[model samples]
Target: VDVMHAAFPNKVPYEIVYDRVVPSMPEKYKPLSRREFLARVMTTLLVPEEKWCLGETKLFLKAGSSLELEDLIALPDEEYGEALFKHLDLAEKKMAAAKSIILAMQAFVYRARFLRVRRGARTIQRIWKAIKLRRVWRAAAERLLEERRGRLAPKRE
Candidate 1:
């Protein structure tokens, strides 16, 4: 309810959404009211229907629900944000090295007048060159976190 209120501040109810909003949706979509959307999201998207209940004035999750943010943050796992950054950095370096090799091979193929081979090499080269660039933002975030953690650690003689 809080999320819904924040998203739609004017307070568009289920009834209004059913009568007016649903009908105006694009043809490819099956229109569902705000109530239906909430029901589906809570039950199907977030968790099973048994995990949550629709009360008279609000929707509440059952006790011991994993849907709670605290529970989500409590789970022990690898720092995936850092892992992903490392993975992407390695990927970019590999891609750059591969591009250099492919370009050299492409020139060799062109000199030999291998039309089909050159065409394929050009396609591969273009794909690697056109790949999206990323700055490994997670590395910086992790470095900041480590600095903060170091400050909080106990110092020994």
Candidate 2:
């Protein structure tokens, strides 16, 4: 194991030669043969597809680095928690941005609606004033026609 560690600082051999890296746990209590120990480590601790790859004669870590079994067992819990915190921080930033966008959209909609209503009101006022002016002009024209007709009529017989 030490030789492999020295030779390939970032890789581990999957062969029985490097099997001593597996530490005995409480359940086993008994000493494990090199093959058994390696099998246990591969099955129970490392996910073959994610953490490491099965090369022809070696296991290549996906992380591009390898550590002793002790380090592997100790680091993950803390690291996973830290990763979650970082993700949460990113999620919060995304949510805040989304909220800001929503608020801006709402403000834009409100302003558009307000301007439309104001325009409608002004249009209504203009139409109403035009109608009143038309009525007044029609009345004046009727009066002028009546005066002209009366003046042109012959005196009563």
Best by TM-score: 2
Q: Residues 1-157, candidate 1, lDDT per residue (tens digit)? A: 6544333222223342123324334342245444554464344333666565544444555555533323322433333223323433465577799999999999987877887778899999887665522235566778989888889987656
Clashing residue pairs in candidate 1 (N, C-alpha, C atoms within 3 angstroms): none
Residue 18's lDDT within candidate 1 is: 29
| Tens digits of per-residue lDDT for model 2, 47-128 | 4534544445655554443444435534455453344234434655777999999999999999999999999999999999
Model 2, residue 16: displacement in angstroms?
A: 34
The CA lDDT of each predicted structure is: 0.50, 0.57
RMSD of each: 32.0, 14.3
| C-alpha-based local distance difference test score of model 1 | 0.50
TM-score of 2: 0.43
